[model samples]
Target chain A: MTGDGAPRTLFGKVWDAHTVDTRDDGAALLYIDRHLVHEVTSPQAFEGLRQSGRRVRRPGLTTATMDHNVPTGDRSLPMADDTSAAQMRALERNCAEFGIELHGMGSASQGIVHVIGPELGLTLPGSTIVCGDSHTATHGAFGALAMGIGTSEVEHVLATQALWLERPEEMLVRMDGSLGSSRAITPKDAILSVIREIGPAGARGAAIEYAGSAISEMSMEGRMTVCNMSIEAGARAGMVAPDEKTFAHVRDRPRTPRNIDALVESWRETLFTDAGAERDREHAIDVSRIAPQVSWGTDPGMTCDITEAIPTPAEFSRGDESRRAAAERALEYIGLEAGTPMEDVRPDRVFVGSCTNARLGDLREAAAAVRGRRVADGVRAMVVPGSQEVKRLAEAEGLDRDFVGAGFEWRESGCSMCLGMNEDVLGPGERCASTSNRNFEGRQGARGRTHLMSPVMAAAAAIAGHLVDVRGWELAEAV
Target chain B: MRGVATKYERDNIDTDVIIPGTYLKVHDHAELARHAMEGIDPDFHSRMEGRSILVAGRNFGCGSSREHAPIALAGCGVRAVLAPSFARIFYRNCVDGAYLLPVEVGQEAYESISDGDELEVDMAARRVRNLTRGEEHEIAPVPEIISGIIEAGGLFRYRVPE
Candidate 1:
């Protein structure tokens, strides 16, 4: 089905299929297959549409939810923050006026836009998905060409279901070796390590296809975690070539296509990169070498292995004085000194949630680590499920009980403490071991320090009261 | 266009720093403007007053698709941001939303442009004139599609020819 008879990468195939038209400048009008809307980004976009008096082009294709600004605690009470309440109400009203399906705050399907898209089967392989949130790339784990758009593009998509964009260059990020051998290296660690290697802008303007043995061996949830942080490396998007694991994850979900079997067969035939296709850049990472990564500074790239010491400004700064200055500033803000061991830095809190790691698998891993253990004294910890559905499933399996039994707060679902748009925020100067993505300055709260890690690592940090490595952690009886 | 520059000579000035996540729920342009660069510089709103050009290091606006970032900067009267490079989504949002200009300059220009340097950005000539320092620098030529969209005033006004 490759039109030009040239071997095409999966990105090329998906992008080409969705091309509505192309201009001379190589800018293509891409038909969007899915549009995921969240409260924080959609308000202005909806307002723009309302101002223009335009109805949604394809209401059925658009799905809305209240996530970013929705409070994760006590759904029964009225939202205390008026601005957040207004925004949530705006989303509800806008969805109603536009006739778009909204998974409201209390709806079973309501959760992080990225999490619910996959859980409900709205995200399909070989599709083009766009959301106003940067982490929309999380859906690329399904092998879709997913990218984040801005509010303006949100309105544009609302009106036309298409937007003009120059084709992104392709990059092949191949992960070789065996993740199975690296027992403590979760997909979160693998991605953090990739970001460390590439720096923040490493994959700028490129859509990355994650290939090689390790990526193939990962579960769908793991793939989602890896793809979720592609934006952190400044990549336009990140994806994996859909395999049987992808199909199995999508099968019989609430929103999957009716002809699932035939679709799977077709996907099996054409969803992968063709032989001999070229990419603008290629980098191979050995998964076995990746340890549990923890971001030590403001940006995700400012990371180190669990066993490594904090990097000095001179060591990490590649001759750029500005980079060194930034590193110095980050250290000052993070309240850490160079050469300090990661394990020695104590955490004030532990958060196991966000679109990146609040899935059922992630919770199961975290719960296992915390099983029969209590959260260290003075270290507040919480586990928020990725979605209500994930919460339901976790509770059904007694995962919630394990977390509660371990003294971790089992809260409701949303993007809780990820960006801290909701009530689950870190106090100023509080350091947290978090399973979410992005350790940017004030990402969780003003002056809040976030150390990005895997769910198990966060759980262990809760138990140990410090940023301890999760490997070989011994779980004794709860005190 | 001409204005004085307010430079933050550092890389990776992220959106969360531009407009902190706490204020994301408020869509008012003016409200967002008040908190522009709140995370990194609490005095940014005051410091940015009367300045239309913002110069910074590499990878400016490096996190989030909040668009609130460009919206906040633009709301604070920033007409153009000159940096070595910009994050992909932030760059597009700046251009596509017609919020502000994201001008990519070489490292020399990015460094040489000083804070409070009165400057003129000539898009047609593809040059930046440092009026205060009396130096001229070439900026990356805006791509054809981008120029076309800008001329037409953002994506909504510019119709892509089929």
Candidate 2:
């Protein structure tokens, strides 16, 4: 690795490259290459800048969008909620007053801030990025050192284009194997399995570099899904060392650099970890045996394979009474009986959207899964594309029609139902099979139970009216 | 012992509960203060009246990167948040804003600290003594990097002279 203790991991290399000042104490002022902004988190940051009378240091490097509180139902009318409308209007004023570019409503670029940064090629390899949303780690899929920052940090980045950050230790998780040959498991399952293995707060104080054959073979969309959940495991960020697949995705994207200069390619090549590079911790998973996963509890760690049973508190506790006590509470909140087969877990709603699994590839897979089948009786299923562009592409390919034909509501793009911020929400105590990231209590609605699964599985859940193992369900009947 | 400790015995307290999405549009600190911890404990705002510190279980501020979460707590008179662990983004936000000190403690220390206990936090000594119990518990010492940020009253004020 760097001949001893020198920066060796890809994260270390990028951190070293972008460092603006080395403080006496171990922290550094990192020059943020990209800063993404949104309605939920930026208004206060803009206020901070105004209070200080500071001009935005680099408006060109920052991008803003309206995502969290925006409605995905109708674009023709104003937001029905006053708070939603106010936040959207405030973001507009902030962007205009600061001369920062904002892809607001009706703009093709308007989407979840995390999704647009990568799709538009704003997220790049070996550069640092930050958004005031935890899922900003999604951009790390492109091998960028991306992180979620707080509102004050958002203001800091806006005012100085830099964030004072403490260097985190590195962890490398390698999943090597071919899953497609036997069973199909998407990156969503891979990461959920990882979080399940290492508890919710397991990777605290670490930046993870996902390596090995499986990660390299994953499509850009899959990598994004995996990296998007890095924060769920409490990792500062997650990267997949920009490879050919990563380069291919960014190449020719509308917002990417005009040309892939040879010099740039060579530098990106250097971003890889040197052979024998020492990691703070290393983990490996035999991905071949991994099945489609689903979270049964509020947190991401409380997941199991679809074929498995809802974990009993006794199984999770071992000898620890406190652990068992917590699991019991979680089970109570989820309203699922222990030792029950996952297949029997009924879901009243099936939501397919969020920064997590709302991309075009995700929609295509979901559309494929329920081509000829109809959503089960009494089940409400909806598809909110990650971005407006994704909706456009899905509609262009008739994917929207397939979903709509199957009784899935094909709606506009926004972070809908992922959190109950928007009007889209579950009635209290209603259970849902969701493609969104977090299943926290009230995330969908107060007392609403959410099972986190991949898009295909969620679609299958809609048709089955329960959590079904998509692997054996003859996924996508004759598209 | 100096300030009173407001104990919250819960784990994985996400940002959503700290400051719900409903008030995310409210930029006023005082307004946020009245709503802080209202989601999880409707009476928490009133309970935190004189206490300037919060003691909690692991993984406090676990979801979303809402700076308002910490800002809300800060406005509610929380000068420091002592937890066994914290979500990375929330911890960084606390350091960046100098809003509240994120004190790391072991599970033992977290359990030992009780509500209304006068906590005399000695950062230099890495010790927190509870006047109520007349007991001392060692806390995890923060890296110099973080303490520097706390001392400078935030990164904005921590700038080197141009």
Candidate 3:
């Protein structure tokens, strides 16, 4: 239904529908359907609006939350950090002045912006969503054209509910083959493997359409975990074609449209890319070959299978001196030798949460891993759910008890320790097996080493006291 | 515009390295300035004493959408960053925010330009002159809308057509 009878991609269809104006150079004014705001990036934006005498154009479409700096511990306690307290107060004042609804720190709805958007159903299929935080791409799991914008664009959206943008070229990442019968292989692993195959900036300037059997078979939460890390692969946005699973996930959410079935029927017609639509580039990966991946170096691309040893600088030096130097630096910073077996790298801490793997399914995976096992001595571990709702759901399922009984800290929801903005952070020189995206130097804390992995892998590392392959956990425990 | 370059001949120099997350709470330009490039170079402010341009490898500002990266750099008096390529969001952020110019250079220019080289960039001519080395290089032409944004001094100052 591209009107001209030519095949169109999902991205093309969404772009055409939301374009308010187009220029000769292909730049178009895009109508933003949803704006998810968090404290870290919105202060300057709201300050800009106040200075310009501009009110939020459509406050109803905008939602604010305190996530980036909110401490996950004891909400009732006065925030000991005065600077963080001021930032939170600024957001509350701005939201009040702008008349935008805020899911403040104590609100049950308060959580990571990306997590609550989908949970509340603000992120709908075929909608264009933007947030200042990079993980805004997480909403693309529902087939929304979601992207992360900067504070300037955030102000633009607040002032006009639109953004001027040049459409990104489309890339197709066809994920063929099964992830196998074992539940150990997760969406986190699948995406880490994809980032390894494609370098960190592999999908630069393009939007990726994840397709094929593996994506189709993934549960909505799993698909979200995959889409959330799309930004880490250097794609501004990544999405899967919405289908029954997407609709079913939305069917019972709080913000579904009044005419759900009718909306879905229309979504079915236009939300999918036509069979012969052209892709600017195509890449394929067999999901069956994907194992639980662990990042050894500074970036996500420096990942390998849990069973593989840390690679040497010479391995990266083949025609790329920059990569080789980066490798050498990463190895030195991460405190690992090239030939060290991944299993030999014992973590000082284990973090089983982040926007990437903090959903209900992810919690269930981690709980299953540590149901009866105790955390290793001298290793500190914690699980921060993606949202308050996820925490409530996990507690209802006794997952909290399992984590606490196994000596893991079960905390409230926020982006805790993921970016280390709050009190939860790794001490200097402490190495952690983290489920968060980005293994960049000091991502968790200043001079902290991060090894990115799946929830199960992180949980196993907590019990085993090292980065052990989750696939071989049962055998190792039996022996 | 003419300025000396501070070169980092590497790829994927992310925003976290440009401005660490710990300083994200400090929105004041002066406070943020003290921490510019704190992750990669603890002495970045001192290093910025005479330099106003940054020359780097590919994918500069490749992580987080924190406008603080460019803001911190601008606060520290960095007017432009020249790289072989850039991450999309970062490029747009620079132009839209008018914090700094993110110029895309070719392999030849990237290799020829050295740290501490005196250079003059002419946006209108789409050319760069390495005065210290007596060499010149062509830069990718700024897109039509981007040039307009630059002329207007940021997106807020520019008017979109109805």
Candidate 4:
């Protein structure tokens, strides 16, 4: 489509390709390739249709799965929790009633809606995917313009098979240079460090496309980790241009075209920003200097490198009054003092699972951290794989043994700790170093305090009985 | 409806807290509303029966773009949510669902209104009247474009123009 005869960037091309109607209000109605639905948000939308006595506009375009409410342990039907059981049943009923295909509980393909979409070869490059889950951005790892929507919006999509969204201003986040040697740093660390530097509002109203040598070299799982948390940094969605890595990840999948070579050639054309193409903003991070990051507060923005001390409320107060209040509240809730070395901030729990960091690599890294060391006494630790396939592959390599042997609870796959949906919850006033996306108050459970971190760091905190630098564990050497 | 605002003096009150992630499975509005704010206060369902306007600090509904949040709140009979700011997704969800009205009143307005003040929200006038204090604070109104959607009961009804 371009002069160079290669796809510039999946986003660049897809943005142009899916233009159904651009409104004067700046929003465009873009055609969606796949609509992934889950139990948590689809019911009302279906009800809305039923009330109107209308059939699904396009049943073939949508797929349903049960993830948010299903417990991570025991794949048996009729969930142990009555409320969860009802919700799962409701999903089964809704899917069957609407004639929508569903990967119900215990299905081999069943997992987090976001994880299964890609693994099942449903998320194709250059396609527009919408799910009710925020981490739907995970599909962008394959060069799709994947974004999350609300129930009403989900209903709108179901009715029209399209979404009206204001075109996000473009931004390029280039992570150039070689990675740091601390071995504790990872793509998760890189993204967290970037969010810390840019602040939460930095990427507001932008569609951020990650680029540069570092991003290109990352595996598909690593890219998913980066894009999954884009919303945390206030981006509409984060995307990586599809490349060889993207093609390799989806090449043999069910939906990928059999003419792989030609498909790659066509997809390559969508792989980069046009020369001198206009962008609203551009920022670069020299990955070499970043260290493993940990959140010491209620918001993702309130984070610092592991080596740094907790920030005093007074420090933030001088800058922005709102930030100051947030810092003070974070201190009050987290029960931590400003200027306290983060290493000294011990956690009662360590959770290494979420759409953000629960991929195979994250498990491998966490397993490496806990391979030989036992979980410290008085610390509760868990390892929930992101997907069933990820769980299978981890067990195939005995990664599960390393985790279980270290005293961490190795549970079945789903969005277990990422959201406190099932029994996987933290008790009141309990402090946790979580690998999940959010650190909001009571996110893990009622009165449970969450501190977001990388999986390796979560493992380190579980072992050290505190939020310590994961590099101190010498995980790389263990491998 | 009259009651003192037992203000949740915090910012970024995410949906997970408003409706715990566990309650999301239940499709029954009545059932889901029963657990609304159970994560924050166990008696929230009982406390928020016919009266109460949640007064939050800033950016309420700040995580996980879940629509059940507003639905759960409305089902529990919450009249309005007054905060300094709201996350984009939650804001849009509330508007589209036409359940709870989100008013973006400045901090000064929040400071002036005492915790025990009985107030009435005049949606049409874009103002909050503190009946206890004999004072009224003019709040920025929802944009006409969005108000129309709410007036029609919800997005579904709004889409079918008269």
**What is the Å distance of residue A201 in model 4 from its true position?**
3.8
A1-479 in candidate 1: lDDT tens per residue?
Answer: 44678999999999889988887777789999999998888887888888888899999999998888788888899888998888888888999999999999989999989999999999999999999999988999999999999998999999999988878889999888877743467888888888999999999878999998889889999999999999999999999999989999999899989999999999999999989999999988998877889999999999999999999999989897987998999999999999999999899999999999999988988887898889999999999999999999999988888999989999989998999888889999999999999899999999999999999899999999998887777643322
lDDT of 3 by residue, A1-479 (tens): 24898999998899899999888888889999999999999999999999989999999999999999899889899998899999999999999999999999999888889889989888899999999988888999999999999999999999999998877888999888988756789888989999998888889878899998999989989889988998888998999989999998888888877898998999998899988999898889999988789999999999998888998998856668888999999999999999898989999999988889998988888888898899999999999998999999999988999899999999999998999999988889999999999899888889999999999899999999988888875521210
Best DockQ goes to which candidate?
1
Error of 2 at A374 (Å): 0.6
List, residue by residue over A1-479, the lDDT tens digit for candidate 2: 13355537788888888887877665788999999999988887898899989989999999999998889998898679987888899999999999999999879888988888888989888889999888888998988999988888889899999888888878898878855732247888999999999877878768999988888778889989989998898888999888777777777878878766663677566888877668888778877779999998878888998999988998987676656776788899889889989999999999999999999888888887889899999999999999998989888888988999999999988988998888899888999999999988777876788899999999999998889988876765433
On residues B78-160, what C-alpha lDDT tens digit does candidate 4 reach at each position? Answer: 76787776766777788787777777787777767765567787777778887888887777756554666678876666642
Q: Write the number of the candidate with greater TM-score, choosing between 3 and 4.
A: 3
Give the CA lDDT, 0 to 100, for residue A88 in model 4.
77
List where candidate 3 sits over 4 angstroms from the true fold. Answer: A475-479
Stretches > 4 Å off in candidate 2: A1-7, A181-184, A477-479, B160-162
| lDDT over C-alpha atoms for residue A193 of model 4 | 80
Better of 2 and 4 by lDDT: 2
TM-score of chain B of each: 0.96, 0.94, 0.95, 0.87
Q: What is the C-alpha RMSD of each candidate to the true structure, in Å?
A: 1.8, 2.1, 1.9, 3.7
Native-to-model Cα distance after best TM-score fit, residue A274 in candidate 4, in Å: 1.9
Q: Alpha-carbon error at B15 in model 1, in Å?
A: 0.2
Scored against the native two-chain complex, candidate 4 gets a DockQ of 0.43
Q: For each candidate, what's the DockQ?
A: 0.83, 0.63, 0.78, 0.43
Q: Tell me the tens digit of each residue's lDDT in model 3 across B19-43.
A: 8888999988988989988888889
Q: Higher-TM-score candidate among 2 and 4?
A: 2
